[model samples]
Target: MPLALYLLAVAVFAMGTSEFMLAGLLPDIAAALDVSLGTAGLLTSAFAAGMVVGAPLMAALSRRWPARTCLLGFVLLFAGAHVVGALTASFAVLLITRITAALANAGFLAVALTVAATLVPTDRKGRAVAVLLSGTTVAMIAGVPAGAALGVLLGWRAPFWAIALLCLPAAVGVTKVVPNPAGDGPGQGRRPSLRSEFAQLTNPGLVLTMLVGALVNGASFATITYVAPVVISTAGMGELWVPIVLLLFGFGSFIGVAVAGRLSDRHPEAVIGVGGPLLLLGWVAMASVATEPAALVLSVFVQGALSFGVGSTLIARVLYQAAGAPTMGGSYATAALNIGAAGGPAIAAASLGAHAGALGPVWASSLLTAVAMVIALPSLRVIAPGAGEATR
Candidate 1:
């Protein structure tokens, strides 16, 4: 809606790209660094770990600073980490750099959500958040693939260099476009106490909303983390086609977010009431028809769609329920999502390790989504009926 929101989206795009591009570059990184694939993959784990811790910590630390200043500072830190990552030859150095970048990315995203909500009308907070998160969908559709191609053409480090370059303009844009709103200035009212921030979690509605967000995200990533292998072994597709299928998933995610943005404004609960079941069904469909190429393609698309479709509403719900602690709300949402991102894959991997077939992840993800739906059903009654429309 506002230019500042768009600039926030740009910052998100750069951060999202960094977060996912590593998935496509793991093989190259493993080989280049003379490490096992599993070790290189830990880089992703490190990043997720950083995000799980950094979001609330940064939010607490920056409580007295202007949102614009926190955003700019975090982006600069992220960019500097990317530069270090790009130059590092040792795997240990790269791992540390990725963690640092993730911490900055987490802080940037948490602040961006709060800032985006502030920039819009109460009725439009969902759409505003959707606009900000669309950057991640766009990154999935374009940035990851492009970074993979860049890695293929040059080296795994090239993508980091590109990410570093991308952050420069985002940092400048935030400084120039985003406002330092009243009450966010330095020496404003007393900083939010740790006890007060944690009190937000005492709200059953907010807590349930966070759990649902985590479960939904965990289910999605459970399948996505191992999609290439699942497609190849189960669908009988060649390796080259994996990227195309992933592209379809990304495209579906983009559409899902666009639609969710509108629906969340009108019927936020429906995101879970309807979209959650759809997500579970999508996963079940994939598990049932994993060997059929057509079915696999359709299932992936549907899974991606429903996985993301409910995301905007989840954020809106948290914002509504935790209105008094908006910054903490944003941070908590980010942390919950990252927790799922990390946990989902671990569960999927364990299922596979237990001799489950290529469809193991599909089954695992379905169970998680079903749990999310069960959680969502009761939580809807806990949130104030009109809370979605109330601005704190």
Candidate 2:
């Protein structure tokens, strides 16, 4: 609840807007660049690839720098990339811009999480993280829709211009408000070596927690990526109502994170153990009620809440397990989440291809989330010795 934490959330809001807004702009981009929709879609893939590669690389590179410096540098780089992207018409140039932006995005998030974790006591870390991550839900609720409207009313490039402008204030906020934590100065305890950082992965609890993060995100995206089509074809909603459905999901996400933040502090195990099974049930409900408008709306809300609730706990779990390498731990979590976001859609698409229904993705999501919960349940023993007592 430090002002710096809110500033970090503002920074994250800009990054999340840029990342999610692209989905709504792809068609305009494809037409403008004279590329196929499939080719333009590669922009998203390129960004995800950059995130996977950049998180650890950038975190390692900036290990010796002050956390404030690293954050300021990444935010500036991110803003600059958006400016270039806004000016570009060529598909290849735009792709490069997205990749560059994503690298900076990854760096910003890893450092932000590290900073947030350090800003509070051990018990409050989960709430602090939730405050930072609420930016994503806010972006989904407001930014994406606004960007889509801007694209339709003005042009595809308009969203990029707005994103670039948004980043400037966030950059300034970080520069002006975020404190440089004491002892994070250059030449702080021997810089984290790549070997030691990678060694953290050897801890089975940390690795499993990271995997759970991936699976949680993957499951959510599997259904989310195709939600618009499902709403239209299955629920009989008009195309114009798609945004409303997404807004409901976003609202649920916001509430979920708010609840998870407090609950994670009091009962981390319940966040996973109880929330995970509910997420699976939510997906199953979605599949069962795909054609029922009222039922589907409720299902969407439940799915969103449970997905993010479980996700926030997975994040806190990884942070706990990877206490030895906090920065690297955050990077690993970011990488795992992006990997799931990228992979879940692909898997769902394949299932749809084979089964031919809106429910296909829902079923796929159910299976993935169920497996994630199973992986998470046993790992509670490894990550928290008091989890049993806490849950009871």
Candidate 3:
């Protein structure tokens, strides 16, 4: 709700848009750059791998700088990557640029979250991170669809150029608006030892929590990477309408993300418990789409809704696991998120492309989503019967 948060959100929206638009435009990008679709898919891999590598490394190193300066520098780096990516002609060049941008994005995302939490009261931590993160979800709703549309109209590179333009002022806005919350510099405060980071992570609850996050993300990407093509080939939709359908999928997510924080206050586990079923039903429905457009649309919407529905619970879930060590716990969650981001695409690609067998990506995602939910149930039970605020 703070203007500072909103500015950070703006930068997040642009970064997220650039990050995800590749999924919707994979075929176009491959053709433009003279590469295989699978090879182009590695574009996502490059970015995710960078995030996994950058999140903790940057978060740890930036401990010495004011959070405001760190954010501003990252945003400039963010904008610069897009500009470079937009201009590159060789495949290797584009790949390098994407990695650089993601490195910047990874640092910005983790640090902004750490800084934002300092701006709000403890009771509001979940809501604060949730709102800040929802900017990424909002991009899924509006930005990805819009970027896909632009790609269809202006070539795949155009969206990168647009992201560069969008990020330019967002960098300025963050420097001008976000308040500097005090941060314990590197090697200051009660810094968690390597032993502490390792020990806390070994806890079963936190481990399962992250595993579920990885599986869910893998489920979503494996199916979504091919969604546009599926609609075009299987559902007989027009090329012009692909992004519109994608938008419908994300519109459902946009609504779910907006409500998730408020719902967490009253019913966290109950909602988390139901996510797997919705994903299963969504795939079942998507399978029947050739004969049922309405059902297909509904399925995609439901998939978006429940996929994100459970996603909202992630930060709080981490807080619960950390128990007494909020800062360490928070860092663990961010790191897990990046780890998932890194691993999901490789797993999804293997499942969808080579071993997909008869049922294909939709069924694969559905099966995995169910597994994620089953695994998450026991982890959710670890939360104090009361809200997490006491220990969180």
Worst 10 residues of 2 by lDDT: 383-392
The per-model lDDT (C-alpha) reads 0.83, 0.83, 0.70
Model 1 lDDT at residue 355? 61
Q: What residue pairs are clashing in model 2?
A: none
State the lDDT of candidate 3 residue by residue for 1-392, as single tens digits: 68887788889899889888888788987888899999998888898888877777776666667677878988998889888888887889889988998889888887777666656665555566667778887898789888988988999889988999998888889878876654453222445654565587777777787677667766766666667656676666677766666777677766666677666545666666665566666766676563455666677777777766666566556655654342345455566666655555455556555544323667667777778767776656753223554334
Deviation (Å) of 40 in candidate 2: 0.6
Cα RMSDs, all models: 1.9, 2.2, 3.2
Stretches > 4 Å off in candidate 2: 184-192, 384-392
lDDT per residue as tens, model 2, 79-175: 8998999898788999999999999999888878877877887677778889999999899899989999999999999998898888888888888
- Least accurate 10 contiguous residues by lDDT in model 3: 383-392
